[model samples]
Target: MRKLIAAGAAAVALAAPAGAEFASDPAQHLMRIERDALETVSRDRLQRLMRAAAEADEDVVRVSYDGDWLAGQAAPDGGAEWKCLSEALYFEARGESVRGQFAVAEVILNRVESSVFPDTVCGVIEQGTGELYQCQFTYTCDGAAETIHEPEAWAQVGKVARAMIDGAPRALTDGATHYHTKHVSPRWAGVYPRTATIGVHHFYRKPVRVSSN
Candidate 1:
């Protein structure tokens, strides 16, 4: 299974688009600051910081590749692929078991399909109100210090992130958008339909009721 997963990841890397836009531009440097601030501060504050970073570093906007300036764009950033996936795993699952970490990623993707959120993985993860506490994932809003001292676990999570980003079918959570540890039951869990249980986490999906008259 591990070999298959690794092979699949490599294939996706090879198949990734070669367009320069898919390549990481300096503007994405702003995301690095945003992600860091999200881990330790409020999302609204992070947005303000991002704007400041962009304005303070006019060179970031003037960064040109060959002769063209790269702005308001996104790229695969294969060089940073491992780092990106590793950070996602750490922030999203540093508290969960291994399987539970992957499950969290699954739920994030599921929200992409629903009408309630944006249609991209990063979008879903970062969507939030002005307040730090209002977001899809609590980690993004929580003011906890982000650190990864466990190298082994980080490697495993990196593998999972690579797989999911590479288009591995989300076979675990089954379109779940909400989940919580077994320690407590949130009020919404009682109303939503239980989907799947992976590791210590309980997954849920919005309920759809069908009535027969």
Candidate 2:
């Protein structure tokens, strides 16, 4: 009876599956499972990398300095900041060329960066308001009503403002924080360093004050 039982046990061992070695050793089985999982993860990672590379190869739209380019763009809309900037450009620079409009926007944005001026677009534009001839932007304190009369001109400046607020390069102005029309030479024009002259505007960078102890 003992010999018959041993023969049956050996027959069962011979009939085990192909991975009997792994089945017999728990550590080996766990290692095989981990290796398969790692392989699957590596395949997934490779697929993601390939997809990103393909996407990177697609065309990207960029800002252009031209009238046709602005006209081609869809009408833009934005929040308070955009409205303030658009209004400023509309009133101050509606007659300016597209390049000139961007230059004026650069001055406003540059002022926002300077410690001397308000940090926000609206704040910078509205500085010194409520008094005649006291505001930073003349249009704000000019006592004239601010209204959007020309849809075409307003739309053009709206696009300019949007492009500027969306991180358009300020190469046109050379970091100008102040600008005036070519017709008027303000007292400060001689004080600050003139950086650029674009269209009808002359751009200047405010001089840094030095203190003598």
Q: Against the true structure, whose TM-score is highest? A: 2
lDDT of 2 at 90: 97
Candidate lDDT values, in order: 0.65, 0.88
TM-score of each: 0.53, 0.71
Task: Give the runs in model 2 whose Cα sits over 4 Å from its true position.
Answer: 1-61, 210-213
Candidate 1: pairs in clash: 22-75, 22-76
Question: Candidate 2, residues 145-169: lDDT per residue as tens digits?
Answer: 9989999999999999998898887
lDDT of 1 by residue, 1-213 (tens): 657655555555455577634234423433454478787678678889999998877533221221122122233234454464556667767567656776777787677777777876667666783467786567667866557888756666666665566565576777888988898888999998898997778999976556787
Model 1 TM-score relative to the real fold: 0.53
By lDDT, who's the top model here?
Answer: 2
Scanning candidate 1 in windows of ten residues, the lowest lDDT window is 63-72
Per-residue error (Å), model 1, residue 199:
1.6
